[model samples]
Target: VNKEHGAWKCHRCGESGSFPELQRIFGDEPEAAQKEAAARWLVFSNALKVCQDTLLDYPHILKYLRHKRRLDADTIGKYRLGYMDEDFIKQMRAKGYNMNDLREAGLIAEEGNRPTFQGRVIVPYLNRDNIITLRGKKIGGNILQARGVSLGLFGADNVRTHEGDVYICEGEFDTMYLDQLGYPAAGVPGADTFKEEWATWFEGARRIFIVLDADEAGMKGAEKIQGILGNRARIVELPVPEEEDSTDVQEYFIRDGYSLEDFDRLIESYRGTRLFTVEDALVEREELKKAEGLRLGWKDFDHWIHPGILPGQVMVVLAKTGVGKTAWITQVLHNLSEYWIFMDGDHQTQGPGIPILMLSLEQTKAELVERMWRISRLWDPWMTDDHFKLAYRNLRLNDENRIPPEDVRVLIHEFVDDVQMMPKLMVLDYLGYWARSFKGRSRYEQVSDSIMELKALAKEFGVAVIVPHQVSRTGRRGERLELDFARDSGVVEETADFALSLWAPHSKEDRAGGDLGYMERADVRIEILKSRHGGLGRETRMLWAPASLALPAAGERGFKDLIVKEYEWLDRGLLYDDIHKRHRGGGV
Candidate 1:
């Protein structure tokens, strides 16, 4: 072994070892060289010590330090910040570092972008070895300006040397911000990207805390990192306080001036475990099961819709335009209202029976109220006074400015809890109207996620959720009544426990006037194409009363009697021949 090689000092552990001993531990020449290079980059010298000390005193300096020059004592002490002026670059160049090396090291840039990082506070991005590989410049004010190339493993390089859990952030400033609070942390250069190698590097950590920006992109980045680190990572999703556009960790430290205790609480609340097995999902299911009890008011529907939305069930109702899908839901709500009154002995005191949450995206409260009034006039004409009370207290989705899924859930839960009742049913009118977060993904993915989330809410809260979906334009005109015509057929069909499709038959003039002049009648057909707990392909029809927005009672006829009448009409050739023919062809 060479004598010079025998005195090699490990930059990482600060241990001295012979070349032969290094070779035995780290393999041969090339590996040893790489290890030595990595070790050299990992040194925690006085420069790093100064950086850490500065950061501990002035964390707020990080926000403005990115691309601005403004500095204060708080920023200076908390962030361990240093300004990289023209002289610093001159000294670095005189030390034999080339412009190309500086550029590759993310320090300098060409003209147009010519090193605008000047007069800015520099936060170094270090790798796991603690060697500074990148630096982020913070400019104090809001004036838009270019900063130097960002480098570093985020919090990994700085925090890895510590023994406890490590907090990872998106920017060097964020790392410094956490460090000021006396937490070990690091930051990556960009908020959106994470190097795959960092995943393995962080595997040794007992737990990894991720503090990302509070925007959509930041959330996505956190999700990606969580996917990479699996169970070892915990996310800290800090929302920006009011009137702020940026909610980065560094920004939070600067604006809110949080205590370490506050941060600990934030971390504790946001800390989530990775779900790796089916067993981890049971807790949600059990909670849903507990929430599945009815609030006791929808006697009419309970009699019709047997087994009556046992906890964790999802029901989908589909219909063509002007076919009274909303009316059907309104009827169900009315039944629930009656049930509540019966349970409490007074409509005013009755809790929102079964916590009915109506997300009527397509209609305003006025329109829904009008329809409710029509139902009341037709079904329970004596209860006009009570109908107003029912209409007033029930939840409405259109009242909010932003209709996110979380908002929908919160509103539903609040109403249910307020009434001291469980939500028995949730009706989402016209599914296509709700805003979806995953905008760029495939339609299948979007629909699947939406439906699944709705199902999860139902399962979690033990309520029956009914979603109204429009029919797709792809199927044959007559067969459009089939469940397969429902929008995003594959996912909707799979997710729903019960799928009901509604269509109106052609009028007497339609058959005689040929297909072109055929007038649509108020006759309605309901095809139960799929049912998880009951029989399938069952068809029922009723003379739909548009004014009342309901199916007329078949004069003492049962549901089975109505089905028999529809079949008898089809057999007598009184119904539309084309629709009847297609129904026979499709074996409906």
Candidate 2:
């Protein structure tokens, strides 16, 4: 055995090999340790020198770093980024380095006697000035590492020394991108590759942000890391669309046009999983007081809602089958998509319409476009569906394709990230349709889980969600709506910030007069059954014009002749008395 190089020679059998080769041959014998580390250091340094000198010869590798990966020359040279071409083994042999030593250093494969990192970008893990290990990153492929090199964190020494906030990214390129921009960052080989023992590496970090890919695997990894680090780590989610396949930082900042300032703002805005202090609660309360929530463009309805619908709130709308519940909310969505002018003290405050995503399981795209046309034109009796379809060929609404129940939460994140805005509203047509997708589960459990998920999603993205719900048959038949009528579970009423039910005074009379398709006009009353933000049971009336699913606003001229009354505060005592008189002698 040669102690200087950790190499051994058996004269009788004529066998020769390095220490790493021996370790690989006999799996992890900690007792048989290598004392002479200088030999390995010599091989590592020589291999890196050869790889770095030959990097510029590969134009494709340079193009990938400069164009696709958005890396600059300084970044490439600073990190000692290199490329190992197909002839890398030949170059190492030309330098008089032995094949066995190269294989033991992880530059060559022992099986085929070929270069281990053939046609891959070589990234060196450094401890200050000394090289730790070499990682081979195949373009759009899997990662390759040294055979026996046990690396700690990718940039452990850098992170340990960094005094400011540190970002732990999912891959090498993401870390390099942040590092090049003057931010402190480290790389994990993959989503599941972060080790529990590596948590101590961030001891000197002021704050650690786990900015992983916003995918299922990445999220699970983030959860694992949060478990390890406890309150010391905060997960930074990327704004990635569901339709998009990529969710890395490179795609978010380079491809999606997100800037460094945007990234900084996102980091600053995020309030991790920690509980809020009393001071934090007081600050939030004051912020909410000064904020103006989204308005539905209806005079009376907006007044009844007072400050309108705030972000991070879920509002549930309930009605029977043909009570125009969908139509009314469709109008609200349209109103939200247009700019509104309102008086704020002395000067008029005008703001752009809130971007919206309408996820509909009940209506088709064509049907929704038809409703948009109807609301836009105010119940045009002369325009046929075929004619409207032809006239408005380019007409489009902020809508989503039919999404599966499981993908609803993912799609919401995608939509919010794609638009890059907050206070954006998502109108899920109804809650029952989503619950029906979960087979084998009881209706009660399905409904309960669905609403709870929505509440969490609302708070997560800081966006308002409006979900229309169906009332129970008994509740629909009653003279007034109740909170218990929120479909199968009471969770909907309990979780939502506002619970509203739409009612038409003579719905049965209207149905008896003609088929629903032939019905032209109806007087609809919106009953505020439950309000966590304001008073409950406030009533407002609107006139549904001929053939129009939504109610016309008070400013609308066509509905003026219909003489729809204004808002009225409901008197529960008088309402019960009227109901009693109507049901008198028929039933107790």
Candidate 3:
């Protein structure tokens, strides 16, 4: 007996119970539930022992299995293979096991205990080291499985020992055979009997090899699972050419001459392949017509993203440590909270700003709020502490955010259904710092997948997403260079609509003689590494102000030197480029 309402579970058959309960735990009454005796697990354990003992009584049965099933002694012992005889019922009675308990536990025949598995081998289903259920395979009779126990996965316990790659088979023989060959393998009773929760067992598993029988039922079952598993799973249709060996993997291996190396070739073959062409994915003009964007407040930063950061586009921020990357984003969010635009000769749109959703994977919720509060104080000279708290309430911030690769799609879809309107700005701070399960993904794989998903999310909601990324130390040696600096990834530069690499003067020479303290004048230089819409290689210098959390010095410099406030181009309906060229020539 384990505990009240708690019993030992079968590993293979997945069945275990003690006796009938006159009453269950009722929602209205707790006293009676606590008083109920615990479920008895000893009954199933003794049944298994007795079954093994009874099977030992018939050594001929074991010999038959060794010859016919091609199973070695190790396999038989590992699986706790046994058999039942007619006298096993008397043995149970001698052991004092209640007949009613045996019936409920599915250890004996419901009507009579004339050895329900008479003249057959009994395969004990074990789970967590306890007998969960049993299966009777007769030498020449029909298969008889114990009632009440669900067919738990065979070799389900093996998943904990390995990670990344798993060979999933449909029956115990195939799974055991593959396991003996040094492959990490597991089995389900049938191809279609997979439980969705089983995915948790292979949490960090990257690739799943589905080794089922090569028939219609098997193929259909594999395809059905593919829908649940997505592209991470591949069905291995054993590449057996000979007609006699076309049925299963076990036969192909048992015949000899075939090694694990040859089997790898068949396992590597991909099933359920689907291909798409350009004609299936061409973006239509209607989508372009409805295109909208979010601005980065400052004219210099906004210019890098053109009219502004477009929906479905990604803007990556890469910087060395202490380079004000985070502070820059904080200032941007504060600006959005206050207004959509500013008319200080740089921004002329002028309106209440778009809403923001900041997924602060690196900072605490309070720390991010404090950062935002500091920026709001900089913008409003007379703002009080109460005002800061009120303003912080408007921005949506969640430090507790993560969707494991297994559940990412489903959970995201659930949120999409619940949300009435998506925010205009989404910030996933410091990508590498997120505390998410790898789900069989390497660090590089995790980053690439995240960047791609963020791109899709932005496009779907017409939001501008800013993701902070880390760069290599070499990329920030203070020497200007055009190289891929995104840590552990080319995907960062490839997927982003524009990449901004910020460098603060780590060298003492550049930081000297700066107005705002040495730390404030990071002597930050923002480079436009890759811009899809804007021209590349554009660079600007900026000064970091710690108190205000902004690029104040750089903003002033760019405003004075390059900002074109000439409204004449707009009045005459000429392109800004045309007017800018004429203005540079002193002829506008």
User: Which tens-of-lDDT digit does each residue in 3-74 have in candidate 2?
Assistant: 322345567543445456566677855543454345666777888888898898988889999999989999
How well does candidate 2 score on lDDT at residue 139?
A: 94
> Mind giving the per-residue lDDT tens digits that candidate 3 earns over 1-588?
233212334464433442222122123435643332123346657767887767667778877767656678887778787777777778888988667766665666666655566677877667667766677777765455665344566777776457668878877767777776777878876666676667777766767778787655566566556545656788776654555534566766765456677887666665333565666445544565466667666667667667677766788888766666688778667656652222232322222455667777777888887766544533443455665645544456667555333233233333343443556677777767642434326778877777776776676456778887876655434665353766765877778888877776554344433343443334567778888777477777665543334564365633222222323233356654453344333210
Those runs of model 1 whose alpha carbons end farther than 4 Å from true positions after fitting are 1-80, 84-120, 125-153, 156-174, 177-301, 304-307, 310-312, 326-446, 456-464, 472-488, 504-588
Model 3, global lDDT: 0.62
List ranges where model 3 is wrong by over 4 Å.
1-228, 231-283, 339-352, 384-394, 401-419, 440-442, 456-463, 475-477, 481-483, 506-522, 556-588
Which window of 10 residues has the lowest lDDT sum in candidate 2? 563-572
Superposing all C-alpha atoms, what RMSD in Å does each candidate have to the true structure?
Answer: 14.2, 14.4, 17.3
Q: Which stretches of model 2 miss by more than 4 angstroms? A: 1-117, 121-168, 172-208, 213-277, 337-354, 379-424, 434-446, 460-462, 472-479, 505-521, 553-557, 560-588
**What does candidate 1's lDDT look like per residue over 1-588, in tens digits?**
223112245665434433434665675656755564444333223333434444444444444444332344564544444544555455555556566544433345544324435545445444443444324354533211122212337556555555568888876656665665677776765565575666766656778888888765676667667756866777676866768765877566656677667777888886655555677578765764555344223343233445456667787888765567777777666555542211122233333444567777777877787766555444333344655565545443353323555455556545654666765677777665552533528776777777877786776566778877777653444443776777777878888888877665653344224343211344556666777545466556555443445454333233233334344454456633332333222110
What C-alpha lDDT do the candidate models reach, one value each? 0.55, 0.69, 0.62
| Structural similarity to truth (TM-score) of each candidate | 0.51, 0.53, 0.49
Candidate that would win on TM-score: 2
